[model samples]
Target: MLNEKKEMPLMVRQSLDQTYDVIRKKSIKKKRTFNPQVIIAIAASACLVVGLGLSNDHVMASINKWLGFDDKGVEQAVNNGMLQEDHHSVTDQGVKIAINDHFSDENKLGLSFQLAFDHPSMLKHVENVSLDYRLKNGDGQYIEEFIPDTKPLKGKNRYTSFFDYQNPLIDEKSGMVQFNTLSDSSEGTIPKLKDAVIEIESINIFDNTGKLKKINGHWNLSLSNNKKAEEMIQYKIQNVSSAIQVLKARSTPTALNIVLSLKGIDKERDEKLPSDMVIVDEAGHEYRIKGLRSVSKNNETIISANFPISSYNQHKKLELMIKGIEKIHLIKQ
Candidate 1:
């Protein structure tokens, strides 16, 4: 057996040695193989971490777009557009404003507001005023209209003037038709005066055809404290005709500051002549008196302050009325 083994050994021994080596390598590979679940879990974890990182970056990019700010590392690829330049300002107590960010270009700012006024020419008789506006991107190109509208504010008082007569004395002093004549026609009512100074509430002028005319042109208005009218002389009305009519029931609680010129003086009387006036709102209660003054030019006068009244309310419209005086120059204090 020993002799036979020796004779056939060389090739067989080489073959057996190669086979052993292959088996050892195979066993080592088997030992090193990972568990299936662990491998699957690790691969999924890596994919999840990568996906989360990408999602965070996307979220940051969206935020940057909304804010219109470039504080973060996210870069905004802004569109190429034009920029517009527009601005306007007014020096009035009745106006206000605000703006937005999408149109990041500061050149054209957006604005909007309202106005309140006491007189017609409050903002320089600006009948039809308008604003032109535009918006653009970072580049200086026009994109959209910023102020898309044009608004207008109007005067509260209407103008009127149309009475026909030859000797119709336009009281250059008061800027109204002289109170010397009364219109007995149907269009207007003239109150019979009981005093020299007539307290006219509101006067409605009429033409020869008895059509209502505008009370435009000049008017004398007065403001006064109530205490002064009480102790003063009361001028009663002697006669009222078509040429001179008094406004009735215009006397308020406050005293009046009379501003009129003596068309014809009856100085032979002991006391100052009373006025041809009536208070439309009063029920036999007389209003107090302050004082009177003739207008500087053309014998016109400005009477003022019959009552010491004040408004605690924030926004009150200021108003005053007078009949004897023909012209008024209204102003704020």
Candidate 2:
């Protein structure tokens, strides 16, 4: 019996030994010898059990599903092969904050995180939390022109946030020429920086009665730009016989930004312009506009329109579809 056990392969030896014991008991009751066919049958059954337990898809899918990564944004990133898994955590006052994943592009950055409290009852008191953060280069120069938006996911501890930054000018020379042609005062040029350091000042959370609770911790993070996943397109559209130059249309994993310049249109008329624009991707996914803000650059009226597109990385290209813009009359000063 010892020699037979030694002869068996290592992979199935333990399982075969247990099965052999059961067969030996049955053979002793029947007054028969330990049959070699019984040993072969038990070994084959052990191999089949091991093979099924080690299957890749079944194992990984079960693990991912157990980790609660079924959020739509997380699922999209995972399916598109763009998800970066980082499990960095910081704990303050019994509250643990973790940076689980992130995605970024030239125009926007998105962060997914989990907040676990030492006491589960504390989760019920968290009304809202705000992150105060900024981007800086290796030389520690700050990038000032950007906007951030935060939203909590369906889970009690999961949250996602995005920062919409200024897009790099298509033509640096053209931007300079337009800037100088429109303004008498001098302003600093916008610097193009990638893979910068993100400095987080503090996280403030409000309670049920509007009591402000501040979590003070300094967290520095560095992220690479997802240029391959981001798409920027330029288009010239004719509205009411006037040309509306879509200077840049940028799509990132978390947001879409469209820069529109209405040439020869009065500022007052541009102020009244509606930002009812929609984006359609190659996969037939539609995104609604979230915000529209006007920034003054010399005499050029640049309208920055932003849309929440959490699954933008899933598509290769997108189209800017606008309705009710052709009816607006542009006034020339």
Candidate 3:
């Protein structure tokens, strides 16, 4: 009876073992030493935070359920401090545009805004609305490879739009990020200026019958880069069969962007290159692929993919899983 009382329960023992394993691996990888007492305290705190005396598997399952790994994932991100809350507004020609919130990282900027029409009748005639926007730096220089993803929510009179813009030239600097056209993509040079002016030349509204109505005005706004908001992690691949390198990863409240470089590609067989990839966290939570783009620069191919993630602050390690890449022949032609 004394010996049995001294033994730890199976679930508790397993949880402690996993906790120790994670701490040991992180300490070794980070080259830091942790006192055993501190480790024990941290383990206890973790267990308490997750649930009183809950197994690791049960804790993760509860977390996954709370995160709602489905359509409500974005709501989970907003609750987890991944998205910024803003109340900026601008009005032009009786149309009010309110910037509600945004998520930004090194590679991309996502803006959520509400558009309210002054007249309810105007909403009926509008089948879609587009912003004609131009982003110029303090020196009037422009950033290159501006790609925009605009999504309009279902509504009348009051509508919401989420705009996602990708800028490879986004650095740790202040600049004006602006837009006003329906949608367009262009290439320009990276701006060196510290600030920028975003000018909206006009707002175009298309009716259900395809008639276009243009509202002409200069709607301008200024934005400064929040360098502290960005979080990036980089890892080097070891003992891999192919020359695939994950250059860096950026995590926002709403999404994760992984930058990769794949070497020795066959230009002739470009279609055979793998386009699908998955990011799995330590708890087996999978972040689905949002979008991907590949560009060739200086004889090297760089790939960038964005994945929507929920509860991103909970995980310490993520695995990048690429599919159907090994079968591709890499003979440069």
Candidate 4:
């Protein structure tokens, strides 16, 4: 058993290990160094983390049972101390429901709630978790679909019914119902949030064989809200015309924006965008896509993305990827 001096490193290591697991499970991810901001947050939150006893890690583990299996961005944000703990729980219809964790970053707000039934065998494997929720601010309410933005869902649904198929939801996290709200709206202007509240109306879960179990209850979870780190740059409306992208070369730049057309793509079926995205300039330097932006109009979906470019900027050809398949898109000079 490790002593007090080693527990701080262990906490961060544990968090990073779990994060690596998620990224690995997502096909292929890797580890990254913690930035100074994250280091500061860990130091501040680890005030009483270390102890003389052997059960040092159990204190924080008990608080966050489901934060480990989320997407890379959200997990990093959680490590940066964006998690708002909720200890309150509600029991109804022979089931106990509790919000495990509520995490917010600059772009999105996500929460995980767990459900336990009175009878053990009543529910076995849960395939899909669904719920009705609304986000409210000091002014009023804002209702959104269960559409997720950048952070991917924790695919933890167990598969016992299908004998031939492999279980895909084999995550470290189980029994946690996860949902996120997309805050990326029209350019600029976000409602001033003194405090944020999540009001969940009902909950439902489908078993591996597609059996629906509905539990009706009212649960409210409040969180400490933070303003946008930087003010959004609003774009002016342009006149009716068509636009085409042309490739250019440079040594270094602050950012790069690439747009992809989704002329006839099905949004519902493809709710989550592919995470394996990158851009390789003419100089052979690779830049990963991080800034996610999407716009839908007249049955067309267009993605506008921005990422940091390297110093060797010979922008001739671009390589786009999804599901490990790369498609080279060439721009006109």
Candidate 4 error regions (>4 Å): 1-71, 143-193, 226-302, 306-333
- The digit string of per-residue lDDT tens for model 1 on 150-215 reads 312122221111110111122121221111110011111111111111112122333323233222
Cα-lDDT of candidate 1: 0.19
Give a tens-digit lDDT track for model 3, residues 100-202.
4444433333444345556545645233444555545576554321212232211122111112211111101121112111110101012222454455556
Best by TM-score: 3
lDDT of 4 by residue, 42-76 (tens): 11112121322222224323543323222233344
**Candidate with better TM-score, 1 vs 3:** 3
lDDT against the true structure, per candidate, is 0.19, 0.38, 0.39, 0.38
Q: Name the lDDT of candidate 4.
A: 0.38
Backbone clash count for every predicted candidate, in the order shown: 64, 0, 9, 0
Is 1 or 4 the stronger prediction by lDDT? 4
lDDT of 2 at 45: 9
RMSD of candidate 2 to the truth, in angstroms, is 25.3
- Which RMSD does model 1 reach against the true structure? 46.2
Q: Which is superior by TM-score, 1 or 4?
A: 4
